[model samples]
Target: MSNRSRANRPTPDLSDANNPHAQKAQNFGPSAKRLFGILGQDKNTLIVVFIFSVLSVGLTVLGPWLLGKATNVVFEGFLSKQFPEGTTKDLVIAQLQAQGDTNQASMLENMNLVPGSGIDFDRLASILLLVLGAYLLGSIFSLIQARILNRIVQDAMNRLRIQVEEKIHRLPLSYFDSIKRGDLLSRVTNDVDNIGQSLQQTLSQAITSLLTVIGVLVMMFIISPLLALVALVSIPITIAITVVVAKRSQKLFTDQWKQTGVLNARVEETYSGHAVVKVFGHQKDVQEAFDEENDSVYKASFGAQFVSGIIMPSMMFVGNLSYVAIAVVGGLQVASGSLSIGAVQSFIQYSRQFTQPLSQLGSMANLLQSGVASAERVFELLDEKEQDPDPLTPATVAHSANRLEFKDVSFGYTEDNTLISNLNLEVRSGSTIAIVGPTGAGKTTLVNLIMRFYDINEGSLTLGNTADSAIDVRTMTRADLRSRTGMVLQDTWLFAGTIRENILYGRPDATEEDMVAAARAAYVDRFVHALPDGYDTVLDDEAVNLSVGERQLITIARAFLANPRLLILDEATSSVDTRTELLIQRAMSKLRQDRTAFVIAHRLSTIRDANLILMMEHGEIVEHGNHRELMEKQGAYWTLYNSQFQAPAQHESQTDGDHI
Candidate 1:
């Protein structure tokens, strides 16, 4: 047995079929069918590649036959050297037959020889040149085939990424409620990239390998049927080995990818809240969780690779055994005068070509399976139910749609659990309504409903200047509804950008003068002027470079610049210091004039001047009136106001007198 057998040559067709980074998959049966259906978009291109691959394989198979002709020229020359000039092979065979030497006479008859003929150097040279041309042409076809396959895979992957991105925007809020952001991100990124790479590595080479098998088998049968049958002994055994290994490796790879997503989610959570982990002394717990998930990924990866790694050496061993059988059977045919030396040489080569593709095919099962699994994850994201579509004919607005009424509105994240039920409320234009409530009281949810972030399960939420002009929020497109409203949340969200850029995000087309006015109104100009870069200073991730109050001011400035008729302030002053809070209050007072505003507050001090005050509990408005009237009622609003402010105000008042 040759040490460098052609059956296991590593000449780089796409890639070496040894170990791949992405693991094999378990669901190739159903998932693989859908996966290929997507890749079939470029049917014409695939057909062109198929034709090229067949031509390449056909040329490659012809090389061995031409070389066998050269072997005949050399063997016949060696036979001619054994006899005198002018003696023919028929004369020698008749003399041997008269002398009763039947064995020698039979061998001489099979020999393709004439007495006194030396080596036909001219024919040998011609056959060698033809073999070289065949090999060269096959290589050119192979290269062209590989380039086309590369384009097909890259274009297919690009479409998949776009599909994933568009699907994200169309998904309902409820779909996000129960899913992990990090896991979904992993599918969009890691899984999609793995599938692209697998296809790139397997496609061109797989087609070529299969065609080579068919072409080589045809040549082998033409040369000798008995030897061709002997060469095929390894097929059944190799298949059994693959099936056995496949069964064990499939689940191992599946667990590996699943664990990878879990690990990524763990890393995202811990990193996003690293400061919280340190403050609460939970560093050890975070590290422990990370280690657990990391270990799970490691174990799964190890088992998958170890089980699949056995395929190569096992297949090579089977091939070597087949090689031994072919040689033995072929030698018997030559000695019995049924075959010649050159024919046996050519049949051995055909056997090698046939078995190599089969071995290659066995290795490709890993990549093919891996692609199907990754495709399944991405397909899941694409197939999730989308949010309800926008209206076909949206409601028109003659004026600002500021006044909002939630009449008999009911909503729940899920159908079985209702968070807000049969809530009815109406607000006049140019009025500021302050909603005060304890935790889980639908304070934020009510504002979200106005913005149409979540559609109500029952009843209509309408908006307009008057009752007669009122339009159902569902009748308007989300863009038309949201464009007329602005929101400032307690949790400040500032991406990595300059102060000016962040302020202009809510109103991208606003003039520089308008942005500056909004900044000054929000008290953002007070600190921004002190910085060396002024409004040009760049913020890092999460805008960590700015102070808490400064970040809040920028968001307020963004909302101010929008100039929407309906403004939602959800604990907007919670992050600011006392003096900054006072300034924001004055700015908010000016912004609320001639506009409708919804203010959800935990601190009663900020909303004392609101036109209408509402106290909500368990999604119900228990008490509502102007501030002075609610204070006189001595009900839920009065009790909550006292509990939150009376004692703290008393202490501050007592200290203020002594300091003065």
Candidate 2:
């Protein structure tokens, strides 16, 4: 097929009703207004931007008017010579004189001598110079405006990103638990970036376009009211088309950005788990999911771009039609001696100028709407409920005594389905308390409450020197409550940093000697010396460079360095082999020596020597005793112990997905 033939073929249907990006619809106006409010915070810079923009636009608006004067000077002489039917040079001169313009009439008569191409070089040069000067000033002002706006936009975006970063810490862990990491990442990075770029491009341009539209219309009316009215014919039509098309494209633009975020999420998740996908032979499934997301993004972007692309051409068509009508009417008025030839030329130029800003504004509206959508997403994140408020006079623990008491504590992820209810416990300072249970028991939930990760739904959890004299945990701030606590979880987390750095994170001000002592205590130094860089070895993404045991050792070292009054170790050695498990057990023995600790373990062997053991089932402790006492009872604890030794493999397989 020829190029023309292919071009003539209709565009494909790019809209998708079933698209994931089409989940929600929003209004851009309020978001846009809110965005403006945010910008208004930097009122000084905004005022300066507004001043430069006005100066730039005001200077540009004078170009056509001045050039029109020069054109009128040249044509006044020539038109007088080409007198039509009843309209003569004498008649025009008489009319000018009659209007008390003797000085202009005298100038026209003098310039008529070289009437064939009667362009007064002196006067034309003067007008051209003035036009050039105006244009130059306009350009300078525009450059200044752009630079200021870019600075303002970058500053605003920086503040926005910082706000999001700070908000993360203030938000409840439950919010993060429910939301995806990739989505939050997109909000902090991609969404904020979209707003920055769009604002940088649109702020000055939108203002200039609006100002130009108004300025051009005013000039047009001054030039010829009759021709201005003709140009006005398409104003409502152009606006109507822009408004209707823009409203439809607003949703499409929002979908496009939303798909962009979704696409980012898919890429982030896929790449992060690429090895798992390949190992499990699930590459095809992953690819299929990615393809579906990619296609949705394409369709949404195409629909948005195609619809927004309509505005420019539609406005151009209306503008051109208006131009033609103005030209015809101006010519008639000129022929009837009601308007000057130069005035007609200026009116036509102004008409083009008028439509130019309208078209520009139409295009800018699309970008503004998209920016607002991103702003709304960002604003939504900012509006999430923060962690409970801090107390006016927060409770404090005496350095010597940090006893914890749970009196009728109860909580659940939701209120209707309570996971732990009517629970009570008392823990002495500097003692190890083992919480043991079958799979699905609330052992871990109990620890989470102790750390204040979740507040109790009922009753009072207090901390003090003695159980009876304890102050409610709620009276103390979360930061203060968690500060003296140390935790090591089943899954070890190490960031992309040196072994020393990860350890130092637990106690940033710890001395080098203290760090080495903690590492030695946790047996981390045993393996660290074998690595090429010793303690300075940098971990890769997710710390995959280290073995599971090595990573667990690093975490134990972290806890040891913290040396907190309270320690919570949850399945710290559950997944390691026999040798590594023994190494971790030794470290645990050292760390738990004389420290107030809550140990949650699946392997009953690790907790056999715990000072006190509470065997939990469902949400309550079914049996409580020392290891020997529980073993003698031949109850839940005895059955779980016998089962672990009887079928170790079966026990692990059955409890693999257990919450506790």
Candidate 3:
């Protein structure tokens, strides 16, 4: 894809019900279900959680009914006209018996009906206490449910994070080449974080809301079926609005996160190359690009929020309509003596409870969709094609034998485009071969192949002597192959840890004495003693505390500690100063003594004493000879060497002419 298309692609509507991606998500279903399946691994915890949730819902549902009983106690006490002031209990009982109102008499007796109008405060108190206790118990269960669910969610997230880390190690280097570091980091950090947060906050609420709706509906039906039907009138309408808005909002959310990824990439690029941006005075352009991405994210977010924001108010309007219908119909029922006043009150509460959860779920549509999008990205990364699967019943190769050859090797970043073709090379055991090439001459490509960072599409790379049929390198596990080789790249990488930890990275089992010896060999000890913490000094993300040359030396010390049978150094000293380069060269020479080393250097003067010189261009070795032999031929190697050695003198003469 061109940079223009990459930067300016229009935001997609991921929420369109007809959108393929959205439909695909529906087809595959939410990752939440898969996550829940992961939770199924702990069936005991799930059962306990389910029990608590049910207990909480049952207690909550019983509250309104218990409260209605209290209301009836107060209502009947105030409305009883049969008991007039100064009327005796015997007269009231006789009057009730004459009227044949046995049920009313029983209710009056149970209430401890006073001659004068008054409420049964003691009974009211008892019912109120029961209501309070039920609520308190319900809250306790709710808390337990939340805590247990949190444990399950966090444990699942932890497992997912570990899997992602392991998956990264299993992926091929080409995967990293095609993806931005920031984008990949976002998947592991931001995307996974999204999933965890959604599960923690939304998952439990979703369950509770669903239970509340069901429990409320049942209560509403029990009170008065006619009024219950009135309340049910809004269900289809609210669902209609929810589905329409959710679909549209889903698309917006996907675009929002896509823009977020772009913005992250922009920030990473600008910050990592801040010096270059300033040097070229391209700060304006960089800022403009960032603003574009930032604006896009803002717009996408606004659209998503605007659409999702409609769910609550729309549902509220529908809920209020339902409330009106229920109240009017319930009042009629009460007036006709078909329903008690207390029942009417309880039914109204249930009606509201029913709508409350629907509103909550409607609001959650946005969160659910966003979480789903993040999960899709994360799952995509997890499901990516890994480096060639480890052979079943894997085999190991012998160490300390570094005779290597590449036969008819053909490879490329993409299959259709072959960069290296029909390449053939052989190196004797324990020989130092220096590779000299210009920019984009496939220098590092060759080194990468040697390290098996990439596999060739055609032909074979073999180790051991060809005399008795060579052993194909692919037969051995990648870990075993790389363990016996040490590499020092031009771009030094050090983790944020103590200097000692970074040095010990190469050989974790190396002793302190061995670490010190390797540091001294690489000349890293010279600067280590100068730092305030000596070997304990810490490094940050950029490792800015150490100079370029200092960082390079530490990496060299790392390679030295590994003491591999084969060494690959790709422009190891290219970024250092003259004095530091000389020191690094001396260190490398010592390290390369017994190993078969492949050194890629642009400086022709540094490899004069190499056992063999392979001058490469356009993925092919154009010349092969030692210094004197190549000089005698005056070919490509000769031209490259003189260009470097004689450039300064040629510039001096040009300057002299200009002065004259």
> How well is each residue in 1-660 modelled by candidate 1, as lDDT tens digits?
111111211221111234222223236677777777777999999999999899899999999888888888898888877888898888888888899988667767877777888888988899999999999999999899899989998998998899888999888765655456666778889889988988888888789888988898888889899998898778899999989987787777666676777688788878888999999999999999899889998998898778877776788889889988999999888877778878889988888887788778778777666666677777777777898999888886755768888899987766776777888889999999999988777777787688877899999998888888998989998889888998998888888889999999989999999999999999999999898799999998678778988998999999999998999998889999998899889889899999999998888988999999889887788988998999898999888889887788989999999999
User: What residue runs in model 3 are displaced by over 4 Å at the alpha carbon?
Assistant: 1-32, 85-117
- Candidate 3: tens digits of C-alpha lDDT, residues 204-242: 889899998888888888888899899999999999999
| Count of clashing pairs, candidate 1 | 0
Question: How accurate locally, in lDDT, is each candidate?
Answer: 0.83, 0.80, 0.82
* Candidate 2: 10-residue stretch with minimal lDDT: 1-10
TM-score of each: 0.89, 0.88, 0.91
List the candidates ranked by lDDT, beginning with the highest: 1, 3, 2
Report backbone clashes per prediction.
0, 0, 2
State which candidate, 1 or 3, has the greater lDDT: 1
> How many clashes does the backbone of model 2 have?
0
Best-fitting candidate, scored by TM-score: 3
Error of model 3, residue 19, in angstroms = 17
Instruction: Give, for candidate 1, the lowest lDDT window spanning 10 residues.
Output: 1-10
* Residue-wise C-alpha lDDT for candidate 2, range 245-306, written one tens digit per residue: 98988888777877777777778979877988999999999999889989988998899878
TM-score of 3: 0.91
